[model samples]
Target: MKISKKKILELLTSGKYVPSTFKAIAKILEVKDKDDKKNLRKLLKELIEEGRIIRDSRGRYVIPGENMVIGDIQFTRRRFGAFVSRDDGEEVYIASDDTGFALDGDRVLVEITGTYRDLPKGCVVKVLKRGRTRIVGTFVTRGLFAFVIPDDPRIKYDFYVPPEGFNGAKPDEKVLLKITRYPSPGRNPEGVVDKVLGNAMDPAVDLPTVIFKHNLPEPGYFPEEVLKEAVKVAKPPTKKEISKRKDYRKDRIFTIDGEDAKDYDDAISIKKLKNGNYLLGVHIADVSHYVREGSALDREAYERGTSVYLLDTVIPMLPFELSNGICSLVEGEDRLTLSLEMEIDPGGKVVDFKVHEGVIRSVRRLTYTEVNRFLNGDNDPDLLKHLEPVKKELLVARELARILRDWRKKRGSVMDISSREVKILFDEKGRVVDILPQERGESEIMIEEFMIKANETIAEIFNTQDIPFVYRIHEKPDPESIIQLKHYLEAIGMKLRIPKNIHPKVLQEILEKTKDHPLHSSIERILVRSMKRAVYSERNIGHFGLASQAYTHFTSPIRRYPDLIVHRLLKKIIEKGHFSPEEIDRYEKELPRIAQHCSKRERIANEAEWDLLDMKKVEYISYHIGEIFDSVITGVTKFGLFVEIPEKMLSGLVHVSTLDDYYEYNETQNILVGKHKKRVFRIGDGVKVRAVHADKTTMEVDFVIVEKENNKNNKRNNSKNKAKKRKKKRRS
Candidate 1:
């Protein structure tokens, strides 16, 4: 058996194996064969690289003691940083000066420098791996040498580019630079231009730079080999293929998506059974059928992880021939799919379910607005023409959706968290028209409920079968974060009792109780900030957000790589009784790494989308500069207050310096109070502000306070002065 790091550490720590050379250690462990000894050496090297093992002066391997820790270093804007332990220990605080050459996202060996207030303080002792080799920045010429300023603020050093490394990049042009040498004692890191990305002001350069910076796929283009394969496999399913699967063409099936949606990966058909149970058939595109394992398409899908939805564009995980054309469950098209046929009771319990490899023809393509309007009783003739037979099905689906929603709420889902999705409208010239919150009506909720149920059903099946799988896990909130959130809420006159062992329902109760309060959004925002980000993991740790013991992404395989993986894993179970031991072992060994990679890629996609959105938001606000906007304080920091315009969905900073009176930040109270003027600005407080400045490059908009509506300090001061004058007159 291959020895794992844990087993090796256990052996060393147990004092069963003497600290010796790798070969000697191997002999002590009864690994006598030549191949076993070689394998043991490889494992030792892996441990050493992971910082779990070290060599003494005599070249004997031993586990690193308590002083050292292995983890990924996260650098913040303020020079200080934190080391998130790879072994899942509490995060160690790293002072700015102690960070040394470790950059953000780098895996390093941290030596515990000391402890501050029960928190472990660490200093970087060794850089195990570099997170980035290429940096994206704007080129600037300084006499003889060119310097590239990184767009990411976390990167502290600018790259010094020699004259030969310019690569035809003009000054102020965006460029991707490759670091040739890291920073030395008194010098900056040296780099050469890898790609010239044209002028920063050009509209075309905006997304391309973000793509290159985030290492996303080349926009709208697939590899020639992948394209050829996609073209070959893009044909419609044949007679034999149709004969082997269930056909759902005659069922009043349809897809409900955004009006601009091109890739429809999931379609639904709901019907009421004779016994009053609901039959919910959620058909997902069978992407695994076309993109086989180890194929070029599969490799590219794995690399992209998920489709990135920018303001108006989507960088799809699959090529257009597959993602948009063949694999997309478009209207009236005979497409291959995997359907989760669930029989849910009136009480929102899944009574029974079956997974099927099927073929489906979506009868209609209805947008969310159309379905929402129909549900709201506005049955326009034009809308009726599109929604036809599926209208009745949608009604049944809506009832089931309400039942499912109630069930989920009872199970601990946080229903009061306001949706943060915003829609950015652009004109024909690609200029911003307006920014508004994306409406979440009943139709959207119905679809969401169905998808959640489908994903949970699939997760439960695989989990019960004891097969290797990937789960979408959202862990409970950290204790420290919960404590901080409670303190913030208490400062706002809201009370939150956090138990020693926190549950999602415990937090959900607080949100539900304050759902109608004026500060509901602020409380929900803090709660969201306090929770951990959901990620893909091989272990089924349960989804805290959905409050499901078993949950995975099973709905949008064409867009998500993990869903595609789930489809493949499920197909193996469907075709064969179960996956072979070898197959199961392979998945067990590889899935954790795949989960990490997909999670990282997902973050990149989110960051890229957010970056483009911020660029557009800045651009939109730049046009309205000097105009006053009614805003609400969303956040308060030492630097200033963060205020958002409700109507426009635009957020800008109200800098402390821009305030007329001197203001002091009360961190514990979570507010800014003017010292003499006594004007108070706390989170959720409404105020009027003028957009003073906006920078597209920085993606920041600055706001100046326009008016202080309730000037209590002025009235109080006037009263005091009058009383003082009256007293002086009486004395005279």
Candidate 2:
């Protein structure tokens, strides 16, 4: 009998059918001919590859269902377990023991066992594909046996190397490896050394190690095709092109950014209208015009999603010819822009607005520091002369920004959450000299308010028109996370009344209450984590954090791909007013995939940036071992108290075993209590700790508590020794 793929699918979908092996399935179908059996095998393979059927570890074929899920598994840094982000928007927790042979980033089939703490728990049934083919690690030898310990903390297992697989790699050296065999029960994965990076402590290898581990694209490197396209498009606007666009070159427009900023993508101008309103012009670089859809530059930017700023290095989303050349809104240069001019009333309402493709010459390029100083009564002759052309517009911009900020606050936006960002200062030799927290001045907030208004105005326009567009959505926090947050707040001696249907206002209120608290920064971070991450989506779900009805990333097109996409869609709307049926269908089909890819890429960039930052923080702290620093208890667990040096924002584990007294963990109160001394350590407690260890490889630090009396004693000892030396000198 001839076997068809449809018949096999029908058999699998039948209520009476049970999962079976290929042989059992063939026998059930009554395939007697050898050719029929071969055909059946091919059909099964096709179905599995198309995700129509799942192949279990025991070589049985089953239909995908509630009991099973497929996703990429990510191991936790703690190595206790892994989480599988399912394709259907659910996350399943897989314990370390139940992971089977699956490694980090592997696409696996998981069998749902039950729920752990309200989250679905599962075990890896089979690995369908490997996410990584190469691994970077440190090679070591133990009694003639060799192994490579993975540099990524998320990878829990070490790969074994046979004698012949060394490839001349010496022990204690950094080496790249190619996996030859995967791990099994009670057996380690095996690999062959591909290449030697360098000695583990060599600073020269640091950049390559991070780049290889995160699969980051090389900085300042572009494909020949991409570079050619960039150069071709990086041209000054012609007179014909300039005539077609609205002329804003004579307007009092300027850009506000950091002193070291190179690429100016956004500029602003404000004017006081006659009817007690403000006319705000937000001009963004027209990156979409230069980077046409389906072009090499466009494809590269979409893949990058956003720029990655790693310390002093930048892995930019677009080539320099575009990002730093034609697309940049440089001072005194006639640049093309997509402008949004909004007439906002005194109540901060955008009563009328127009989106225009325009050309502008930035009258002045202002730095945040100088503008801030000028606003705060600085009257230096040179500074005043430089800002003379656009100073009045800047003042008007600040006034309008204040009104908008107030309007957002009244609408229940979570605006007071301080983002903790540190600037790592480097000396002439590229050594980290100091780390300072980046302060957000009034100018920074003013620019932010203006951008928010512009983004919201654009998003509202497209959403109300029922057009296909990408939105930046921030969903409400999960109920379980809110409950946990309440518990955490109670432990910190704050009481919160959580309603069944919570709103962003409640979180805003919590932040407001904690603004002056000693642990304000820590509490802010916890609240931020408790909320869901903001992501790009084709559906307009609204932005919870900003408390905006409709929001999209319509700014910073030079750096963000989503914003570039928005620019394209806006231009279409501007030209045609509405999409044709075919255009609408095409965008509807493509927008979701584009949104998902861009969101994933953004996450990858963020992780890579944070990884490099953590590495640098550890490297800086390595030189300060044996020094005492004041810290705050950020976390309390049975194993240890996690403390962070507030000044440096460096965290380390204070193991329970090193404590002066035996401590018992109180889960209800989330505190560690000393059994005999009655001393308690909970989140937000101030303590002085001595840095005991710092490991660059693991990116971990260890700290021990220093008693208050001991610190005083050391100070007294130094004073006495100084007096004795002075007396001895006098006697001589």
Candidate 3:
């Protein structure tokens, strides 16, 4: 008696039941039996939920159109939005009026009305789910009521807080508010103050505000149950457990990380094999052994997905008891690890590899700076003492790392593009003292190369076995993005010859061709933005950037949930040699959702980290408001020219309105041309700019052009001529 929803929808759209109510439709469909009628009703409900059919004001079910799509609508500050489909289709634009009560990040059913200037336009028909109920904002109390002004720009309307829900928060203080009622067409959403964060301008409250704004987990507060389990798991492995692992205590294993880094999850060791090959070992802390499946700690870790490292603090996925203690591969401590042994040839090929559980005591805990110095013969007594035992092994590791790097470079055409990551140093009062980039050294690259190889090895092994696994997949870039990139390159006077069969090498070649250009960094960033974002997936789409057929995240289990899952599955495969049918089926059924959840969580963490960095950068730049600095025109848009101060790596906008002459943006040329003066300010042009404004709420900086050097020279020449004329007149 179960009616197919698809059949119901097809019949409704087929026009026979046109404008028919539920009772009439039921009668026409010949559903006389009570059970059959119930099935029909259920089918109708299902169809409605799926957005295939909708009930009109007169209670008749009808299909809106073939263009009806379900997706998450991301609204901008001005109310215009984009509908991001769940199935990864082309985005649909939702005009301000078309977005009916659909807030930012809200899942909704949208019907594509028609094309607007070649872009698909949609209207929100129904809100499937609310993305957020609470928002972090500044509280402003009026006579009888208050409103929370959302910090996120995408939230167009302020949440109205009734007097009772004000929670004693003062005006201008940042507060977290929970929506009591959603906003209708004409009414603003109603909310109540849930928690009062301190003054909005206080430097001390910045991090907390950001954490709340992003719904990031508070540091040091674990669920009581999770904490108890973590505490139990904190103890070092017992002798029995150690006995089960392969002992590598005598190996020259060491961990290289930042000096300020905690929770060291990985260590590396290498030795010269007699056959002219190298034996390299990558030991990762075996967090999966301690965090059991379906346990509170595991659930929490899964929820976090990845550790969020802000400038001064880290919001770890696992509790400190696990992350910084037992799971940390600290020097002189016997830590249990899931180790990867790779026999790499001189050509940087991993000839053979094996994954196994191992027990290792790191001989030294070294920083990248220390290693870099050691390689340069900076033999400080303490550094020498720590590194002397592993000097030969270190030399071998460096050679292998170089070989691997060179091999990767030779194989891929695109030059690896990386920006120097900056760290914000805060004073005791939480004010920014210094913002400096973390120096990249060969030691860092060595570790990176080894990790990449291990990840690839693990992915290859599991992929060939046909097991359900989470892969770090980077798909091919969209054709539209490539087209835009080509136009941008041409605007910059660079010719990019796209191959008939486009691959990573094609993009790599473009980078190589423009390597010496002043706009290389900007071009590289554009190229990166044009590519698809890497995400976790059950499907094995080859990693486009790495040019690898198989790739997965297999290291840092203590910090990354995907790595933890990889560890658990890897351990199972190693033990059983192959997974049973049920095990495979279970993983297949569950991995898609897991991959999606983890990917989403990672994105949230990344966004939150970036936001905090932007806030810190603004705070730092605010001190230099009137100072002029040499900046590069990094981006040109219709509204403004984006400039980057190369020395500080700080970027700000030079708004079109700030220019003395009227400016028109040439979209095709990717430059702004002055209407009256015909002055061209294109990307990559160096100019002096005064730091004009830095706003915290908007997280934006504004810059006005100070006279260019050439202009200053011209003015100097004119002044000299005028002075000479005055002197001649005086003499006469």
Candidate 4:
């Protein structure tokens, strides 16, 4: 008798087949020869590796089932537990004791043990693959023993380093370590120092530390082949290429961005038509034009997924020759673009539109500040002169933007959530000088409105054509989250009725009602949290946040990989009119995986940026220890209250131990109550706090309550404090 891989899979998949050991399977198949048994064993091993079959604890070959899952494990920020994110989008919770030495981001086989808090609870049965081999941390030595404390808070364990593995690394310095041994039930992981970054306090080491910590690509380092391809692809638009594209080189088209922005990926132009409609043209850099599909440049860009813009630095997705040179819609340079021209009526209805590959030379480059100043009636001669060329265009753009914004609001878009963005200013020596909250002026809003309209227009086009496309989808809020939000809202004394199947319009109404409330920011923060995160998807479920039926990111191809893919898809449609059946099938199979990869990469980039920002914030606040600031409690937990300083957008924890009275956390109401004094601290409570400590390594700030002002409101607390002081003196 003979055995084969196909036969093994068929047997396992058969309804009558029961899980059996290698010997049992061989006997059932009547494999009497020794060589046939060896062949059967090899086939079984290959099938298991391919995930076509799995093994039970008793070493029997079985099919994967609901009781078992394979997924990547992500530890919580507090490191108490982890969640395994499976391929089908289900998350299983893994308690700390059940983790079986699995680290963050490892792919593991988990056996579903039971249920925890409405989610499947699981334990790691086997670690299929390690997610990371390198870690960035601070090296320390104590009495002939050494270890590296990881900078990532999610990574809880300290990797032990042997004396010979130090590799000349010094104490308290940031170093990159390569893992030599993984952890087990009883032992810690071990690593060897690969490179000494520098002193933790050195400003020069900040970028490298964050880069290594996040496993980001080194800035300005491109593979030789990628660079060569970039150089070949970044050439100026040739005569033949321009002849093929719609030429808008002489149009009054220009770009508006931040004063410091260099990669101008999007440009705009507008005009009022005779029928009182606005002719708006949005030109985005055609990044896919240069970086062909499956090329080295495209592969590198896909791997990066998106550019990481760290404060004062950037890790770009494409090489400089493409991202900053030819692909950037620089002033007075003819650059290739995918243009969307829309005819919007006064009521903000898009009556007609056209999408085309075009060539445009930006007439001028504008900044948000100058355009805002001119629009706000600032009469400075220099400012007026700087924007004189396209003054009418700017005004028309403003008019059209207002109409579009009002239309979006009328359609129930979530528009009133005010987000505070802070700009960390650095001095000549790269030291933090100030942290100022950035204001979005009218010009900023105008650009946002235009971009949104363009994105919606492009998305609708592909969706109507029934083409396989990547969409920027924001699903509706989960009913469970909305219920929690409703309870919290009631607790905060806002009596708003929430429906089980809530609509985005209801959320909009809530924001409108709470716009002037003292806890507006806190409410906004909570509402944002209650909503699901927006991600790229091949399935168009509509964007709940923006109140759009179809939406995609078609702008900023220079920075975002999805936009580049959109461009390629749009170009394919424009050139071929429609995809062949085979092409459609291929894209249908590929787009979901691509969307998932890009979504994961985007999340990593966002986390890295936030981590670096938090580090800088802690560094800045370290200079202001003991200074009192007004703050609002944003979160309540058993351990402490998380408060954010509203003015600077800096947040810190007010530990329970730091409170004067012994407090008990009320989990149901999400509040903390003093055991004897009856003092209550809940979300949105205003308090005066003094910054007590800041830890750069942990990226955490500690705040202590300043009782002087708070005492004025509570005489009992003051009296209790005096009584305690008197008792302490008598005891002394």
List, residue by residue over 1-732, the lDDT tens digit for candidate 4. Answer: 667887878888899998899888888888889888888888887666545577776889988886888888889888789998776556899998888878888888899999987799999998767888999999998788999989887887899999889999999999999999999868899999999999987766778888998899998998999999998888999999999999999899999999889899999999999999999999999998898999999899999999999987889999999889999999999999999999999999999999999999998899999999999999999887878889999999999999999999999899957766789988898877778888799999999999999999999988999889999999999888898788778777788988888889889998998888767777887899899999999999999999999999999899999999999999988898899999899999889878988988898999888888888888888888767799988888988889998778888887786787999999888999999999999887899887767767777677878888544535434433443443344223
RMSD of 3: 7.8
Local distance difference test, each candidate? 0.82, 0.87, 0.83, 0.88
lDDT of 1 by residue, 1-732 (tens): 566667778888885667787767776677877777777888877887667787665778877778888777777744456554464424788888888787777777778978865578888876766778888888988787789988766778889999898899999899999989887678789999999988886666777778777767766888899999999999999999999999888887789998889999999998999999999999999999899999999998898899998767788899999989999999888999998899999899999998889999999988898889999999589888877778789888889999999999999886747666788887877777788877689988889989999999999988998789999999888788889888877766777678968888888898878777656666777899899888898998899877899999999998999999999999888888688889988998889878877887887788888888888788788778666789888788877889888776678787776676899988878888999999888877888887766766656677767665554555434433443443344223
The candidate 4 region of ten consecutive residues with least summed lDDT is 723-732
Strongest candidate by TM-score:
4
Error of 3 at 656 (Å): 2.1
**Can you list the residue pairs that collide in candidate 2?**
none
Q: How far does residue 103 in candidate 4 sit from its true spot (Å)?
A: 1.5
Question: What TM-score against the true fold does each predicted structure earn?
Answer: 0.86, 0.88, 0.86, 0.89
Off by over 4 Å in 1: 1-72, 77-79, 84-94, 112-121, 141-145, 168-171, 516-519, 708-732
Q: Write the per-residue lDDT of candidate 2 for residues 178-210, one digit (tens) a residue.
A: 998888778888999998999876655666777
Residue 27 lDDT (model 1): 63
Over 236-264, each residue of candidate 3 has an lDDT whose tens digit, in order, gives 88999999989999988999999889889
| Candidate 2 residue spans exceeding 4 A from truth | 1-68, 112-121, 163-168, 184-187, 709-732
C-alpha RMSD for every candidate? 8.1, 7.1, 7.8, 5.5
Instruction: State the TM-score for model 1.
Output: 0.86
